[model samples]
Target: MTTIDKHKPILVTGGTGYLASWIIKQLLDEGLSVHTTVRQKKHKTKYQHLLDAAKQSPGKLKIFEADLLIDHSFQEAMTGCELVTHTASPFKITGIKNADKELVQPALQGTRNVLFSANDSDSVKRIVLTSSIVAMVGDTIDIQNLNHGVMTEKSWNTTSSVNHQPYPYSKTLAEKEAWRIASEQNRWDLVVINPGFILGPSLSKRTDSTSISLMRQLLSGKFKMGVPDGDQAVVDVRDVAKAHILAGLTASANGRHLAAAHQKDFLAIAEVIRKKHPRYPLPEKVLPKWLFKFVGPLMGFSRKYVERNIGYDFVFDNSYIQQDLGLKFRPFETTIEDHFKQLVNDGLIPDKRS
Candidate 1:
């Protein structure tokens, strides 16, 4: 019932990010005017890919500077925007020394700041918030207690804390805060796209993305001896971007939409890479949980995380995004294939030809 005004600009936060870059590209491909934000205008060089994406597309692009911690930083970009895809949030699992300061505050406050801008805007009617599957379940083991051993939109991460699983904890706090704020408003509706560990081609060559870093570590034989039993609910980044657009434009789309495709472990990921480059030193097996439990702490993961997540299978029910948004997920093989190809093309990871 809802049809977005194509002429009206859509605002996308975190334009230079791996996932956000894909979202912005799709919007431009659709010939929709997109206004995007980065931390500062001086960093415009990082967004040349976005500029290039718009070159052949009919869509118009505008760049703005905004900060997550600064109040009203997103207001100017969001002005006259009927849909604001708030994709600006930190995602990091390793090297987090201060959870609250480094992860939680920015996510919580960035969401708050964006909502504040929306509340003041007369044009914004809906917000498609980018949340994660981690916000639904604290650990892979938590899904075992679900009704059908599948994580759903109804799930809430109760196990994560600022100390343990702080990244998930930050997403949980931010999504919870969003719901709290939306309850007090009437003019706008909030739609959440809760995707899993997003994988696939990134438009930019930046190495800061958590997914990119993980991909690099895997392809570089960092875990050639063996990878942990950790599993991921994989979803294509392109599909995730489509979910945001559908959630914004589809009038009937409501509540949280789980945007994942498959439930596979780290070994499965390595196997997919091996198909293209078998000679590369890819993991052939998973390390024993008992052994990983001891070495987990040495590799940035806490002993508690090892106990709870390792040797567990995490399954998710993605029926909502598919049925509601009419989203068709890309194959896992395609996701990994395109991702590795992009990395190799950019020399982010050298292509080894034997």
Candidate 2:
């Protein structure tokens, strides 16, 4: 691993996101100057926590306005930074009306915008990209096709497209685009963190992402009846953030890293939440897979998605991240509990456990 120049500011795009927030926090905590980009600089309330963190920590923080879809918008923030971390991308799973415009374009073009900006910058030496495990396997059933039932860094999501699992499709294209751009240049190298479903406390109070939305449903009794039967590869938000830092600064950090910690079903997650708030009627069992296959369409998932995803086992190989980054995962129990309590502390989840 090479040394990090603390004097050089590291750029982290999409500073307001669930994962990006933690990334920014760790960067600041390490006393490194951080240059972060938001869609708009006027939304002070949206990023006030970051300013607060900067004030309290030893690191200097500067916020710049950037639009992911806008060409060269990230150039100002990325200029003169030796390390650039791209964590900005739209992550909506449901309510997508136009897949190409809403998901694919932004995810793909955003990477284009950032990596191009990196190319324009002379000081850049390394870049860390935030990618999802979905980009490795389109759906859980796709896992069955893997040689050893484990997803490695070599896995590429070939099953997603504009019509099916478009979110994963977007991520797949975006990461590929990053690597493709990196290959054309030798000045800067690329490192990718392919994390599974990230959980744990979010620094911001936003519930925009699917992960936060799922946690809300689990705690707010939306899934009190039951969640669809499925197993998901899961990881802590903090661990993912640390992986980004490691990848950005470590000279030896090359290629993609599968950064998930464990694989667990929905019932196991609910059981963790229910240990303290059992009266909230958290899911005690999985909703029958056969039933969800029919109900999935109404919930916005395609019938094929339900058929392929529901009731499928989740198995992952996260050794790449563990071995290269020397990153350790937080306990699954801590991940669930800390996330649940954050929602409660922020009043996003009410005291309806009675």
Candidate 3:
């Protein structure tokens, strides 16, 4: 593996995303120039925050227009960069009219486009991919069949399909395609960071992210009575961003690393919020599994998903990331509190009691 030049700018795909924005901020803070790709250059409002951040740091920021499905769109931005971080992917959980067109194809083809550009770029030597834990296990119940009942980097999701759990299926296919492409070439090494449900203050005020939406739902009394007893491996957005930078810079970081910090259910997350803001109507009770199975459809959850995930614990072995990257994660309580405070401060969530 070739050592990446700190002086040269690095390429970060989907720079306006919640996770990508944090990664860009850290890169600029470190005095490293960044080349970021956006879907439209005309939408200056989307990436103005990145530019503002660059003004405060020694690093410079450049924005380029790129599309995930369009071949060679990322080539110009990737030129002269020794490392590339691919964080762009469709992440919608519901209202997906066409899973193949919306989630699966874009994710799979986006990976292809980015890696293809990396292959064409002579300066590129390593790639840090933003994969998710869904690629490791489709549902929480899948963990029960494992030897230790915990997911690791070696685990691969096999239960998800285009029809059911389409988001997880998309991630699984995308990461698998990335690894397959990386194996065919020797010029650049591939490093994948599989983070769990990411939550933290977003760099932008955008509420389009699922994390922000979920937090809003919690604070808005949508689940004041109770929430489904389903566990999700969780990680802070900042930690996931740091993992990408470390994965790109560290020579030994070649394989997949799980970046999750804690394993907690929806109700546990609500409890964390309630502890900080007692005024908010955060759910304290865990809804029964059978109740979830009955009402999950109203909330856009499939029967198969509810059957396989509700009441099951989602655990992961995150020791590899800590041992390999020397990463110290912030406590889950802090993450949840900070996230809730950000939303309230930004006026994104209603502070008044129902």
Per-residue lDDT of candidate 3, residues 85-146 (tens digit): 99999998988899999999999999999999888899999999999999999988999888
lDDT per residue (tens digit) for residues 76-167 in model 2: 99878988999999987888999999999999999999999888888888889999898999988988899787788988999999999999
Worst 10 residues of 2 by lDDT: 1-10
Instruction: For candidate 1, write residues 1-354 as lDDT tens digits.
Output: 445676899999999998889899999999999999999788767999999999979899999999999999999999989999999999889888898999999999999999999999989988999998889999889989998888889999999999889999999999999999999988888999998988999998899998899899998888887988867889889999999999999989999999999888888888888876887778888899888888888889888898888888878788888888999988899999899889999999987945
The superposed Cα distance between candidate 1 and the true structure at residue 6, in angstroms, equals 1.7
lDDT of 3: 0.91
RMSD of 3: 1.4
Ordered list by lDDT, greatest first = 3, 1, 2
TM-score of each: 0.98, 0.97, 0.97
Per-prediction tally of clashes: 0, 0, 0
Candidate 2's error at 113, in angstroms? Answer: 0.7
Better model by lDDT, 1 or 2?
A: 1
Model 1 score (lDDT): 0.90
